[model samples]
Target chain A: MKLKCIVIDDDIHAINGIKSYLNTLSNISLYKAYTDPLQALTDITGGANVDVIFMDVDMPMISGIELSKAIRHKTSKLIFTTSHSKYAYEAFEMNASAYLLKPYTFARFAETLNRLFPQSPSLPNISIQQEEDYFFVRNKNEKNSLIKVRYSDIVAVESLQNYVRIYTTNETIVTYIALSEIKIILQDYPNFAQAHRSFIIAKNHIEKVEGNTLKMVNNLTVNVGNSYREGIQEYIKEKTIRTSRS
Target chain B: MINIKKSPPFIRIQNWLAYKKFHIIIWLVFMLYESVIVGLFSGQFGNLINYILFYSLNISMFYVHTHIILESGLKRKNQIWWKLPVLLSLELLVYLMIYIGFDYLITDILKYFRPRKIGMTMQYILGPVYRAIYFMFFSTGYYFLLKFLSERKKTEELEHQRLNNMIQIARSENAFLKAQIQPHLLFNTLDFIYQNARDHSPIAAETILSLSEMMRYSVDSNKDKDFISLGEEINQVENLVNLHQLRKHHQLQIRFWYDDDIKKVEIIPLILITLVENIFKHGNLLSQSHPAEIKLYLQNNDLIIETSNQIAKVKEKPGFNSGIKNITKRLAYAYGDQSTFESGTTEDNYYKVRVTIKVKHTID
Candidate 1:
């Protein structure tokens, strides 16, 4: 389904900037852009069935926070595009799907979109083959070479656009395979778990769990998404040390 | 003008005494002298009671006239001139009547104890009335003298405060004047560049726009306000990061993360920006192995900010770490002992700054 998105920002320039960026994405369409928060609030409440919203935090009459509260139930996903880091906590409180700081690059914007619509149409050509405790992924650099990656040697899988960077014990390989495809191939492996929207990690490779971040054996720190946190916790629950006072 | 209510009782009493000490000392000395004279002249201990009654009445009348009557008159000094003589005459007549009534009552009571030597005559009544008039004149003079002296002291205090305020303003203005020129020039130049580059290069225009935004924030945010929304400061930090990234051609790896609910938090402006700027100024951000990281999160009620960067092998320019010093000073001024700021080079040679501010009361 084409994602119906709206942009609400006080700055016309910012709205235009976001519009230009939205033009490049094929799966998402900009439904409307509002410079006035009250008008946006009105339209949102007036039965505009929006799937996603890109909102600015600092608005004149009604803040993005208040507007989000007003239309939160109507929208499927809420993304906050702000210039300040201070609003991250507030955006989180509002259960924002993604937070993009101002002056963000196209790559960062694409990353947020991927997280919101992970199963979009562009991700169709991701194919993987598994054989006896190992997987073969088509390497993008070497057009026809299929790289062999052992399940035991895999440390993490980082998603970059339509490609996945497979970090192994011996070498790092960039393969032209989607993270979702890799997930399907490794679904039956009890040790491999999705740590973030853009990351898949081996449960045993995690050296330490520090707050929302997972420190891996090779010093790769992967963030744990709010949605995927439960699965990671449950995967490590049995292995966690417990002590009781007698 | 003075906040008497906020002062403790002891201090209030001391202030009262400081203003009225002269009048009180004079009254006490006169009372003592009068008692001695009356005892010596009368040569009879029985007359001491009359003197005591007369002195007590006189002192009480002086207090009532000076503190109540004169105080009110001085408070409305502009209007009191027209009513002064009439008010004084009415007060004197009341005093005379009170004295006469008290003298008759005291004499009648004394007759029960001793023989009455003094008789109820016109001379006797007139003499006390005359003495009451004289005491009124004396007390009124003392009251005016106190008013004049206190008024002078008040003016001197006001002048002192005004001078102190002027000096403070001058110091700030001096600092403002020193810092204003470069940013104004730089902002105009950036605007010119933005206008020129808009049609040719959108990226250059965007970079200039971001630079001007950062410059505007740095100039305007700290003008009169000590605190700004955390969101505003973060925006400037983003601009700083963006500008640096563009300068380095996207070679540097930088990551900024914060807790999701921290937008409503207030902090002294430019604090986080200063820390981030320090990284660009002194740290080796070009090394992708150790990407510069900035993280802001909440632990309980405290807002914690941590920034880490790898120490550069080659120093571009010598820095005394004045940015960190300024941040510490500002935090100390705003939060006092409620905030903690610590910065040092870690064991891995990474320069790190950790700031934890107690925000339980500040956050809504």
Candidate 2:
């Protein structure tokens, strides 16, 4: 099914720019565009089945942050577009799916969409490895060679276009597999988490948490994406050692 | 000069009498005392009437000398040296003749009424002359006293008016400075243009957006406000770096690292941005191997920012150092002795600046 999206910005030119970009993509359909934020709020609150929303931070009558909070429960994905990067923190606080800076290229826009709705219907061959501690995938470099990746030995999975680079404890494997397929197959595992747009990390491998970055056991520093920060923060809070002065 | 026409006659009279009331009261008391003393010495109640008459005559002579002679003579330039003395003596001689005629007239009238011989001795004429001179000296002192006091009052009034004018000028200047164009309107208009250009020309749209962001930061940060959140300043710094990168056609290498939790910390605005702006102006950011780097973090309740860039071989503009000077001045003003700011060139020709500010918890 094509994702249903709406664009709301006080600037008509900005709405048209986003509309033009969305028109080029086949998987997402632009249902509506709004220049008046109050009308958009009324429509969304009146039970519009919108799958995603592209909102501007600064708007007349109501701020984008305030509107996001008011209608957050009605939509599944929320993406904030703003000229100022300072709103990134507030966007994260509102649990937005992505924060795109103004004048972003089409590629950057597609990257955020892919991360939000990875497992589309076009990729129907993905399947979860149930009742097992390991999965097998074919390597891209050496055809016909199948590699066994133990769930416990997996440190992280990084996406590079159509290929997935699996970092294991002893060696690395480059497989001819989509990141969405791997993400679907590993959906049942609670220990692995998507940390960034191009990265999925194992919770046990996180050695240190510093600001918006995480250091893994293999000394790889992965930046935490704005949308996934809250979950990572909750995980860190649970494991952090609390100290008090006597 | 006094603007006598501005005050009404009644108010002027009230003011004059109020000013001279002390002297008038003192003169009346002295005359009454002299009358009683003379009456007691002569053992005659009739001496009281004589003392009253004498004092009244003396007051008339004093007014004639001061108002008619001194004023009319001193007002003219050539009459002040010689003509003034001649005018004063002639007026005094006329006053003496009138006094002698009045005294003889009074003695003759009394002798006719009582049918008794009244003594006309040399003592009577000389006593009246001596008293007349004494009263003239008193009038001269009083005239100079009034002149000195009025001049001081005029100067005091002028000084008060000048101070009031200065305060009015300062207030208007402050209002003029605060009346700059609102930043929100400028940014909104720029955003409209950016949207229109993005479809056909993405690069142009990006440039407009970046320029608008930089302009918004510089204009919207109210200089009068004391503190701003660090997160907002960081965003502006990033926009500055992006704009400079576009200026060099994406060849400039820059890296910025900031602690996410420090977003809420309040700081004196524009200090970090100024240091980064200086790097773009004078530092060699084109070096791929050694990119200009900015790092901000908190260390033990202090907000610390460090920036380092390679020094360019080209000579900088004469006023390029003013950015750093302004930052130091602002830091000193806000933090006083609590903040530390240092900048120097390393042996490897890398320009570096480090600033550490003591953060207070009360700022929200």
How many clashes does each candidate structure show, in the order listed?
10, 0
Query: Taking the candidates in order, what DockQ does each have?
Result: 0.03, 0.12
How would you encode candidate 2's per-residue C-alpha lDDT over B1-364 as one tens digit per residue? 1112222244443455467784465557566655566568767555444555667788777777667766777788976999788986786677667776656666776432322333456765566567666766766755665566678889899898899889999898877555443343455567677777765655467678668756756665566878888988887886676566545544565656665567788998888888888888888877655768777878899999999999889986677778888988889999998899999999999999999999875334
Q: Report clash pairs, candidate 2.
A: none
Model 1 over residues A1-246: C-alpha lDDT tens digits? 778989998877777777766776677789999999999888889876788899987688987788888888878989887655332335355467778655555546777888887888323232445448776776655653887789999999876434567878776676645577688788889899998766899999999989889988878787786668899988778899778866
Candidate 1, pairs of clashing residues = A83-B235, A86-B263, A87-B263, A88-B260, A89-B260, A89-B261, A89-B262, A90-B260, A90-B261, A90-B262
Displacement of residue B5 (Cα, Å) in model 2 is 21
Task: Indicate the residue-level lDDT of B244 in model 1.
Answer: 69
Find the 10 residues in a row with the least total lDDT in model 2 chain B: B1-10
The best candidate by lDDT is: 2
Return the lDDT, model 1, position B173: 96
